[model samples]
Target: MGETFYIKNMVCNRCIASVLDIFGKEDYTVESVELGKVSATAGKKTNKSALASKLKEIGFELIDNETETLVEQIKVKLISKIKSGETEHLFQSLAEEFGKTETALSKLFSKSEGMTLEKYTINLKIEKVKEYIQLGQLNFSEIAYSLNYKNSSHLARQFKTSTGMSMTEYKNLKSWNRKTLDKIV
Candidate 1:
């Protein structure tokens, strides 16, 4: 049977590609790679220690412990939902999606990650807003609605609070202040 590994800091498509390349370079036969998981078969010559070190060098982590694996799973699920414009029913659907009660998942996430899941979700949303603003393809209202914000004002407040700059100021800045999706946490 192939082994499945949970990965940390795998919050975007680029992260997936990076992980696949890392495995490929090491000549591991990757069965599948997804948001925060990779299934692979290690040959007899495979060196797991070197693999872990390489992954860490590029800001990705291979999670083998149970608690960390669960935490990564939660993060992947939340990020996927947010990016897919499914923020409308996040709280109601999370428990069912993760096969645990909301309270249980919340407690576990908080204890392991040292932050509330709500806080993490907001950070994810704010990062997406930054991306949209940087793209210059949509206005604040469209971004707000797409990200399920109640209104532009609310989005503005959160964006300012998170990044210490208003959205307009952020968009007008000479240098970009956006963080990679994996770095949000």
Candidate 2:
């Protein structure tokens, strides 16, 4: 049976590919790799210390604590939700998905992450907004609608609060700054 290793800061498909490459280089038999987790059989040639160091060098962490693993899982799920535009009843949905009460999950997230879950979600949403703006495909109203904001003005307010600039100002910038999903915090 393959062992599962929880990872920190794996936020996208590229991260999965990077993990797969690392495992291959380490000569492990990888069963599967996904956001925040990998299932693999360690071969004789596999040096776990080297693997962990490689991951760390590339801005990832091998999560050994059960609580830290759970927190990373929560982060991965939240990122997926934001990407899929499922922003309604977030706490309730997450609670049901994790089979835990909202309060319990919130407390756990805050304790592990040093930020409230709500703040994390907002940061994710703001990053998504920056992406859409950079793409120049959607108007402000459309972007707001896609992200499930009540209205464009509400999105505008939140965007300003999060980014320290209005959407128009961001668009007019010579260089657009965007955060990688894993670096949202």
Error of 1 at 165 (Å): 2.3
The sequence of per-residue lDDT tens digits that candidate 1 reaches over residues 1-185 is: 67897889987788889999988777789999898899998877778888899899999998989988888888888889888999997966988887889889889999997889889899999988988889999999999999988899999999899899999999999588777767766
- Please give the lDDT score for candidate 2: 0.92
- Which pairs of residues collide in candidate 2? none
Look at candidate 2 and tell me the lDDT of residue 170: 97
Q: What does the lDDT come to for candidate 1?
A: 0.88
Candidate 2 residue lDDT tens string, 34-104: 89999999999999889999999999999999789888998999999989989889889999998999999
> In order, what lDDT does every prediction score?
0.88, 0.92
Off by over 4 Å in 2: none
TM-score of candidate 2 against the unseen true structure: 0.97
Ten contiguous residues minimizing lDDT sum, candidate 2: 176-185
**What TM-score would each prediction reach against the true structure?**
0.92, 0.97
Model 1: worst 10 consecutive residues (lDDT sum): 176-185
* lDDT score at residue 60, model 2, on the 0-100 scale: 94
